[model samples]
Target: MARVAFILLCHKDPDAILNQVTRLTAAGDYVAIHFDASAAPADYRKITSALADNPNAIFVTRRVRCGWGEWSLVEATLRTLQAAFDAFAQATHFYMLSGDCMPIKSAHYAHRFLDAHDKDFIESFDFFDTDWIKTGLREERLIYRHYFNERSQKRRFYAAFALQKRLNITRAVPTGIQVMIGSQWWCLRRSSVAAVLAFTRQRPDVIRFFRTTWIPDETFFQTLVRHLVPGREIESRTLTFLMFSDYGMPVSFYNDHADLLLGQDALFARKISAEAHRLKQVLGALYASDRTDFTISNEGRTLFSFLTARGRSGRRFAPRFWEAEASIGAGRSLLIILCKKWHVAKRLTAAIRQSTDIPAFDYLFHEDDTPLPDMGGIERSLAKRGRHHRAFVRMLYDHAGTDRVVICLDTSSLDLLGDFHADRADVRILEIDCDLGDDYLIGHAIRVGLAGPQTSRDTFARLLPTIRRDMIHERDAIRDARFKNAARLRETATDAENAAALAVFLGVDDTTALALAQTPHLFVD
Candidate 1:
């Protein structure tokens, strides 16, 4: 097996840091530490003294006074990578991690997995295409310059932000480089690390451009890897599991996440706070055992159940589509009933099953008031506003790995047509009309149930045309909206304010404003 080098960055939780260092050292892996300069000298010394006897462990002498969303983080990581490469010349891979991160898989299993795969494990996504930060809008981070002091002074940061906005001194990325954003953590081959380091050394201009950019640490390496490396050799997935809150902050793992963490194939999990003493203990015990077969405890199962229920009720995104899909079966057709009326949904489900012999299929009713079974179904909490229908659509396509999905929604749920435009081939929508004299079904599957039971294969054949027409109309509407919004913004602003206002209107940064303004649909919809 190839030796793995771990580059850890830490500022707080000295004890947890030492434990991580000790664990990696015990696994016969090289460990490089980059303690924040603002951290206490006593804490640094404590970490250093604990690893004094381990020749494989080395703390970089050059430290950084790191601040959130600052270039200092990138500099510190580059320095640590260089130091690790210098110390362990034969190491095959470099894993960028944080002090709060701990390996979930055994060292042997991780090494074996890495040895078998030639590709680098780094999550990189086109910034314009995906919501990397889950901000609902994708381009805000790329457009604005976010400045924070070393101690995270909110007032100072906001004041600077407002000043920049007023003065109209917008920051721009380097020319000819497409912005790519992803999780900061990654596992890269040694050659890839070297390539990144060489690119930075050769392009000092790129470094300077990103220095003023917000959250450069997340974008810098990702942009380089996408620009420099072959796309085929990069697997766009991180090996670490980081649970994020609705506000985009990384949440600390607790005993409740034990089953979730244990079930994941990711090698590491991160952002473990010092307060989670019991979680740390459980993880430590699990990692210390040599046995590969482990079972979730009764308490873990109970906690998982509670968390699963809470996750569905919460307004945030919940990824239960896979469990729902699996409970039904693979290859089984899925009918997602998005109607608010329970009787309407029941009639639709019954009509579909009675009318068609579409092989094995299951029904998942999504309603606000009617509570469906936890398994093979989803029920929205009545107290909360439900705007996460798009998230549910995304989960079906992106997470659940379902190829064929039929959505049966009422006229009120027609707003969800926007989500099916991109994946119309894989998804079909049946717009059911509850009124007696109106067209009963008005989507891809058009059926006029006002006269008689219009349930047949020919009725289903008209679905694709209706769907195509709806998709085209929706797309055109979105295109027109973007154009009108951009035009309105351009007309209302003065010459000095046009660039900033245009960027805001287009939902992109000034660096991308010219290109984005020309193609407003790329960023807006």
Candidate 2:
């Protein structure tokens, strides 16, 4: 029975906004929309006319021309919030969302949690005490007077910034109020929101000071909420899952990001691209579900964040900048075989070589016996490759000819799974479980001297390579997820099935693959 008043600040993507407004109003939630005056007039009319019949949707007439790092963004939010508050008096909470934002969690789940814990979900930290501002002016954003639009008018904006810094111009903050800064998105209890509105009318001096402050939208609500709400009642975290690049811009979400977004504990997410049809569809479906027992979003958040950072900002654990391990580029058509039974893998490699015109290489990555075509002596080559994940893959791509080349993954090759995830454009990964028996792994381990012959299957299994033991750990990232949908072929699989898998990868027919299965062993170690 908890009603939320949603304040939506939208500039583009009217279709997405209309979908969001419709979904929210249909679910018995109220929305106050402020179509930015800077946006296309046709889009505004398109969205408003579509939602005119919905009693829960209210369009703010006093729209402001909003821009980044400008006071207008904050003013626009206030106007929409006030309009929603006046219309939906029964609303218990107010949630702020953007044009690119959408709920990832169910309304029932949100209401139940909000009802149980009457906490204000807003991130507020002492601005002067934290290193939160990475790219912009830190403490000067608050202390220095700002008058120009920071985003659209960069030269004049920085000119004013320089003039203030030269003259040592400082603005005095009102007494007894410690300035705070946080994310612009938030979910707050109605009382705290109403208090903010009241503070605006009562303290014109504070408003005037902030109006000249750089990116006041990020600080105004955050600082005011802290001044009004008790520390105990405020949870210093927004209920929206937001991420930013090193450039301080919101990371846009695409269809492939569905898993990461769905696994988030946040009720909502932003910067979801309108062109991301698949992700939008998935969110639309999940938002309607009443289930509260959802997957824990924080469990995988750390690794995903690391991988994201690794992809965007070149990885720290690599040799050079762009040559980040997870971003190794392809120089030729490549197919990588991930397997356990090396002896069996060699047989398949031989089959591919003898049965067709294509060539296959095995033990190409063995630390002692790797065979490179162009690189010098093995020692010098290994030294040149540097024995690093990024280096190994880069060396391989450089020597591997423009024509198709096949190599079996080696245990000696450091973790290239991340690199494989990135360069899978020309890479084809196929996993084969060539079973001898339930004890086959143990027997193979012993035969290969990987473990003691007397050891149990469980012990031998543990001695296998990481990929041989576990298939999908870091593989959870990127297009390499296609490994999940790949056909699982056994050693004794139907010659047709085996042929099909090999053929699909080799770009040949099943007949050629069958011939490969019978060909003489040619890939000698």
Candidate 3:
């Protein structure tokens, strides 16, 4: 087996970090961990003590108080890489990972994959070609110097802005290097790692230049690798899978995402929290299983195809709908109410129209029969309730743009409008806040058949807490049935039974279903 070096940068969740270390050590790989200097000494001690018996595990002493978007992240990574290289001279590849990351494939498979490929596996793209440029990140992040301290951030930002406006300071690309940006996670050959370290050492000026630049972690390694190996073929795929929210924060995985994670080609998945104990255990067991073949099964592939088609359809329709809305000009503030109960929607719409002027608003009810704007073949693909809601919101944003305010009234609109929040600042989300007693609410739901006739008073009483909780938390029970079912299964079923049930439910093989079912229900409110 080819030796691989794992360089992990961890700050919080000592138990999860320890579990990762234990698993890596068992895989017969060298593991070097760099705990954030800001982390508690107890945490460091707990992790180190757990790994004391393992010869392959070593703690990187040269730690830094790593701050987000600061130079400290690069420094910690360099230190960890250097330590791994020093400790494991026979290692063929170096894998940079976070404490929250878990291997999606067996270690043997990862080693074989790396040994078969000569090119570095790092996601890189031209800096100017990225979406960040459209968001003015070029001016706010690259052109100006941002101070690390929170107290001085705003002051330095405005000062830099004023200076740029007054002096027209054109930020130049670093000497002898074209700018490249990518995900921070990467898998590189030992030779590539050595070359990167050497380049950083040889050019202190390059380090200094990126010191004040925002999120240098995303660019530093990418720029260096491209600069050092000018003509080398760089693979634009990172081994790690990270899903981001519309707000740009990584969406942490839960028990429900196990099937998706297992089907992915990525060797590793990140941002796993300790609270996801079931997920941690499932991934840990897979890592220890030593199964080399990580290919997606036929069922997984079919599901992937379906999801991909749905995504493509959504992308196609969203822009076209936006264009049509734009052509019509800003007509009126869109009032969208998504409710299955026609009576409830009618009552709410009437009350709002009576209290406020209806002439200024265009009322749209989101129901099964509601006709979506004709988008050629794309309109046929919006059969799924969730997808329809998401597409509708995307169209509304595209039509209204950022200038006009869109008022949304839906129990499930918050999640449907997730991707729109960052871009659609003009959207005003309003929920019907009711102060009616539980008896009234239960009676109403019963009348609407939302609650079954067989549901007894005692059962309703037990459900009151859930109702109150949902009210406060803004839960969409109908839309979140899968998650709710998973939570209920975790409480009621054995791990093996849960796995079997999930396999049948998700149409996945037993292994994939087991992986997901074994994960802890960390998403429970």
In terms of TM-score, which candidate is strongest? Answer: 2
lDDT of 1 by residue, 312-386 (tens): 423222223432232223333333333323354454344333433322122332345442323224334522223
Quality of model 3 by C-alpha lDDT: 0.63
Q: What is the C-alpha lDDT of each candidate?
A: 0.61, 0.72, 0.63
Better of 1 and 2 by TM-score: 2
RMSD of each: 21.6, 14.9, 17.3
- Candidate 2 residues 1-525, lDDT tens each? 688889998888897888888888777888999999989999999998999898899999988998788889889988998898899998999999987887778888888878988899998999889877788588888888888987788899899989988998887788778899899999988899889999999999898888889888879999999999999999999889988775777888899777656656688998788688888888887778787766642423343343454334232322344455443454555677766556667777777766666667675555345545655553344454544544455455556544576777642222454355455346666666554343554454445444443343333343444324332333233234454324344555666776677777777876787776454432222
RMSD of 3: 17.3
Give the candidate order by descending lDDT.
2, 3, 1
TM-scores of the models, in the given order? 0.59, 0.61, 0.57
The better-scoring model by lDDT among 1 and 3 is 3
Models ranked on TM-score: 2, 1, 3
lDDT of 3 by residue, 339-402 (tens): 3233444443344434333321222334444444454434444354234443444454464343
- Provide the lDDT at 189 for model 1: 93
